[model samples]
Target: MAWMYLVIGGLMEVLWAIGLKYSDGFSHPLISVLTIIGIVTSFYFFSRALKYLPVGTAYAIFTGLGAAGTAIIGMVYLGESISYIKLFFILLLISSIVGLKLNAKVEA
Candidate 1:
């Protein structure tokens, strides 16, 4: 359950990150509102996960997921450049995330 919350939070982190790109420095009214909402909602779920998960592991995974997700989305949907180096690093980050998850023991 806590892992589920963490995943949701990480996805929401992706949303808010994309939202930031579309928000245009907060000058775009509707996107800015949605981005703010995304930010709050992401934090809510992340905090829920923190209640049960190791903070160090959870936070590393959270930010790592966000960074990797955002990078992928940018390349796929936002016309951002894709390169082999980026792909390699994204894979590395994902590997590290899994490593952390496996090593961290739940409090239960």
Candidate 2:
């Protein structure tokens, strides 16, 4: 359950990040509002996950998921540059996140 919350939070983090891009420097009213909601919602979920997960491990995975998801979305949806080096690091970051999850000591 905590992991689920963490994943949701991470996904929302990705969403808000992309939202920021589409918000046109917060000039687009609807996108900007949605982005603000995303920010609050993501933090809500992240706070829920912190109840059962270590701060360091949860934070690392949370930010890692956000980073990886945003990068992938940028390339696929936003037509950003894709390079071998970028792919390599994204994979590395993902693997590291999984490793942290595997070794994490859940409090409940």
Candidate 3:
């Protein structure tokens, strides 16, 4: 369940990140509102997951997932160029998150 929340939070992080591009520095009211909602909801789930997961481990995983997910979305939907160097770093980030999840023993 904690992992589920973490995944949802990561996805919300992606939404908020993409929302920023459309926000026009918060000038676009609708997207700005959605961005705020996304950020708030993302943090709520992240905080909930922290109740059962270690802070250091959970936070690292959360941010890593956010960064990687947002980068992928930007590349695919926003047509942002994904260079080989950036891809390598993103893969490294994913590996680190997976390692932490595999190594950490979170209680339900």
TM-scores for every predicted model: 0.97, 0.97, 0.95
Candidate 1 per-residue C-alpha lDDT over 1-108 given as tens digits, one digit per residue, 9 for 90 to 100: 889889999999999999998998999999999999999999899999999999999999999989999999999999999999999999999999999999988776
- Which regions in candidate 2 have their CA more than 4 angstroms from the true location? none
- Per-residue lDDT over 1-108 for candidate 2, one digit per residue giving the tens place of the 0 to 100 score: 999999999999999999998899999999999999999999999999999999999999999999999999999988999999999999999999999999999996
Ranking of all predicted structures according to lDDT, beginning with the best and ending with the worst: 2, 1, 3
- What lDDT does each candidate get? 0.93, 0.98, 0.92
Task: State candidate 1's TM-score.
Answer: 0.97
Please give the lDDT score at residue 56 for candidate 2.
100
Question: Over all chains combined, what TM-score does candidate 2 have?
Answer: 0.97
Candidate 1: pairs in clash: none
Better of 1 and 2 by lDDT: 2
lDDT of 3 by residue, 32-81 (tens): 99999999999999998998999899999999999999998888888999
Q: Total backbone clashes of model 1?
A: 0
